[model samples]
Target chain A: MKRVGIKDVAREAGVSPTTVSLVLNGQSARIPDTTRDRVRRVATEIGYAPNSVARSLRTQRTHTIALISDRIATTPFAVEMVQAAQDVAREHGYLLLLVNTDGDHDVEREAVDALLSRQVDGMVYACMWSQVVDVPAGLPAGTVFLDGRPAGGGFPAVMPDDRAGAMAAVQELVDQGHTRIAYIDAGEEPVPIASRLRHEGYLEVLRRAGIEPDPSLRVEASITTAAGGVAAAGELLDRPPAQRPTAIFCFNDRVAMGAYRAARHRGLEIPTDLSVVGYDDQQFIAAELDPPLTTVALPHYEMGRWAMQVRLGVLAAPTENDGVHLMPCPLIRRESVAPPPAQHPAPAGDGE
Target chain B: MKRVGIKDVAREAGVSPTTVSLVLNGQSARIPDTTRDRVRRVATEIGYAPNSVARSLRTQRTHTIALISDRIATTPFAVEMVQAAQDVAREHGYLLLLVNTDGDHDVEREAVDALLSRQVDGMVYACMWSQVVDVPAGLPAGTVFLDGRPAGGGFPAVMPDDRAGAMAAVQELVDQGHTRIAYIDAGEEPVPIASRLRHEGYLEVLRRAGIEPDPSLRVEASITTAAGGVAAAGELLDRPPAQRPTAIFCFNDRVAMGAYRAARHRGLEIPTDLSVVGYDDQQFIAAELDPPLTTVALPHYEMGRWAMQVRLGVLAAPTENDGVHLMPCPLIRRESVAPPPAQHPAPAGDGE
Candidate 1:
């Protein structure tokens, strides 16, 4: 048996194929409702499938958006972001095509080209980490970056206020009587935007309190995994008991878990012996920890929604000098931190 | 600045636009390399961007695959499957366009229509759990389902051999002298294919050993979350101490965690008091559990790889009679189980 085509629907409905096409494509707003209904009913009865590719050719819009992330599958934040983006896209009758590049510039370039080839109306480029790089040339103008500063400028972005969030974490620690707090960063050299902002926030809070920063208390690790956090904790513990800080701030939750594990291994009671503060309230880490972690919550889902809105033209296009849209990160205080021991002495230089 | 057209490239390269189009589309097997190079260079220098929509119109190939999944962002296994599919697609110069339907039929229909409209070369349909659904009409022939048995047959699929894997778990328990094994299945009623198959395997193994199946020993719950598992375990433990089974088999790792919690709550020692075996060896549940769980490792990554290969036509299409591609679920023996206590007397009813 031969498949039914648009011509058969038009013939059955006593109309032209063009009329059937117009009605099926939802351009029937100007057409008579009776005629539209008749055509639609006939088409449905015959199972007349409209050719989408042909329709797309007639109208330049593909009703599709491309989301290019630098390895979104592995990152918790990226997962939330993608979910939010999908939610917004579905609401707007658009489909999201996600492409993960594994942070490779070449792959990024190829992905962009491929999305463009598919005629995606717009693009959202979300990097795993905010690192400076030259934007590849030849992309369509309707592109925006998510959680990163756009290279070569002009593109809009949505990012968390890392500095303010970090400042809040430290300020809370200070309010709780922590004078010699150590910032254990689980990120490599030439830190990414979030890391640098967080580090700066740590310093600013200390400066405001008139407390001189201790260089010995600052630590860095290669990655933000729990193992990296463990290594950093090991280094801190290796120092003389008199020199160790009362509390430690981790870069993220994974690092904090490692710190918790290391402290457990060393027979140090959490909060009672050494308070540990974490960033990014990842659920698995926070819920399963022996005593839940006190951490900063990054607005990943909101960022994703904003990213999609920006791409869909629902939000205003970013202008030059618009700077970053820094969403606030709130602190979720669980059972991880407490005041220092009464007998522990303050750092010697801070008293001066 | 005005956009450079294909005509401009043709003019610069002293060739027809059709010739230039053919060479740029990689249909240059018949054309000389020197001529192809000249056309490409001219196109690049003139900043001529090919109109991909027009190219697609001529070729009817999008070089894109639609990966329709039920909540790709939240389901860990689904995320890995999509990533593996993307990796495979990328190798073949195909882009993966993802759509998350959240298991809503309306959303699924919309996504299917949208992807179909985009003229995706093929489709990979992955669901969080298997259920019966009519295959949407008017789709291309290359669409395949993952983790779902094809409706009305003919579509290729990749799924675990739940029955065989379950039998292995049961056989292991039986070998350890667990005659009265409890099956705490924390899965919804009209159980998923995996659960049902595994249950069948469980029943088959017991019958073969000349043991009458006891319905009291089998309990079902709404889901496989740790909390659900805990609830199922609690119900099982409600039976008098004398009648409780010597061993327990959980639906998955999450459920197993709940079982561990339940056992701990009742002051029952793992393995010694109650031996437990789990399925789907999720990392956190296996590694972080107090005694570490003895669970079956599902080949998540390999399944992902196979799903991609099958969709891309790199692997042979499976037939309906082939049923599930049962991957081996080798038990990872941790400290979770041991032989039943020798002092405990067997329950009454031994008249043969």
Candidate 2:
């Protein structure tokens, strides 16, 4: 029993192999519907099945994209980048391949080799945490960076607007009529590159508001955890009531939680006692916390969608403007912000 | 200019195409070292760059696996499943393709068709939340389900051991001398299928301990959120002090947080007033919850790695395993659970 070939179908349908190929591949718009129907019926009657491998070789298009990342699956919320990119790729009739390199350069090289060997049309390089990354060798056209900027400056990058986000968060606090705002930062290393951008934004907004910079108000967290927030907040609040800032801007949501804990420890109620704002609206932390949290939203999903679009655009026609593309980080207002108290008071309520 | 082909290199090196191919592909074990070195030198002199697509065609292996998931990116914490699987796939020299269908049957169908057409070697079908799923049509050889069970038999699956986890949690509570233990459950929808299994485990443990189950001690909350924990806990503690259960097991960590809030609202301290245990370690939630939560680790990462291994195994040689593969769910001991209080007292302390 021999597999029926396309030529056999063409002969049976009284048409050329190209006509049969067009009809079978679903690219038969130019061909007549009646002829296509006849060709399809003939192919079905002859049991003709197109070979996938042969088709790929002939078409030179796999309709696939590789998503190279440093451990997206392990990161809790950052999976949104992959999810959104996959959705966009599916819409464009492309499959999104995920390669988690585990921060091992060798594994990443193997992944790129495998994907390239399979002839993926494009790729989107993403990072679990936003940072500056070294561009991989053999990066073809249509490759875009998501959440990480390329250090070499050839690849286009799509990232969170961290500076603008911090500025907006501080501006929101100021709009609520609070002036004395302190900045809690993750000390160094391991902290995302966007953290520095956010710190810059915090200072820029503070200067614009004419609040003189106070080095005493800025506390660096050694471990970059909620414990850091607690210690930093404690440092600021332990000072004389008159000298203390009315509000605090945390680098991220986890630090904000620490600040919340610190405020509670000092018998200060959120908003009513200390207006608090956080970044990266991590849903579990922000919504689940008591009184909820007002924070900055990282546009992870949208950035993914935009990155895919940019990749597709590069595939269509190469463009210049290798500059960074910054997506907005919107402010998510909850119940955590309020005007500063007239005077810090002694505990009116007992332990909560 | 004509591309430098393997045949050209072979001609220049005075060797057959097979000898040249073996040397260039790093498979020169059978050939002499001198011959290998000569072929390599000639290939390099000619600037021979192997065409990846042609190599794939000759090899007949894509070294790719597809992960068909139901909204993994949207669901928080479940990304660990992807991360672990991706790492495993990378270890095996396979690129993992992600297809997030968002529960759309059409998109899922398209994903299957596209992956099949692109000749992916295997697939790992996963769900963001654990549940029973219908096997997709036209599932080829070398496929496994992750964090979900195929409704029909004849497929391998890897999932968290929910029953054993619950039993272990209950056993831990019993070991600490708490008899009047209660169970709080999420009402109906969105309550993971594992919840029912956990409930069964709880009952099994209680029966083993010679403790008769109390129906009134079981309170089903409306939503699966922290608010649900609060309401259910409030219902349990609203009764007379003599009749109240000493220990309560909330369905999940979020609910446990609610229970924490409820205990605080009632001026009851965790462990001293109420011993709380949660499920799904949910690092962000469980670890950050002030006293932290003593909960069950869902084994999401392990489950993912196991699923990928199963997929690779299937690709190697398919095996039949109709039964569910229940991975261990370890207990993470935190400060949340403690021995039942000696006596239930009325509100005494103002706060902490």
Best prediction by DockQ: 2
Per-residue CA lDDT of model 1 for B188-283, tens digit only, reads: 554467778778989999999878889899998567776677788988876886678888998887777778778867878888888998987765
- Backbone clash pairs for candidate 1 read B161-B326
- DockQ of every candidate: 0.36, 0.54
lDDT of 2 by residue, B1-352 (tens): 8657899999998889999988887898898889989999998899777765576666767777888998876567788888888878877777778888887887777678767766678888998777888777767755788888888867778778889999999999999988988889879855478779889989999999999998888888788788888889988888898668888887888888888888888888888888989999886788888788899999988888888887887333234446568899999999988888877444777598
Docking class of 1: acceptable
Worst 10 residues of 1 chain A by lDDT: A129-138
Q: Tell me the lDDT of model 1 at A38.
A: 99
**TM-score of candidate 2 on Cα atoms, chains taken together:** 0.91
Query: Which ranges of candidate 2 are over 4 A from the true structure?
Result: A1-16, A25-33, A42-52, A314-322, A344-352, B1-4, B22-33, B44-52, B55-59, B314-321, B344-352
TM-score of each: 0.80, 0.91
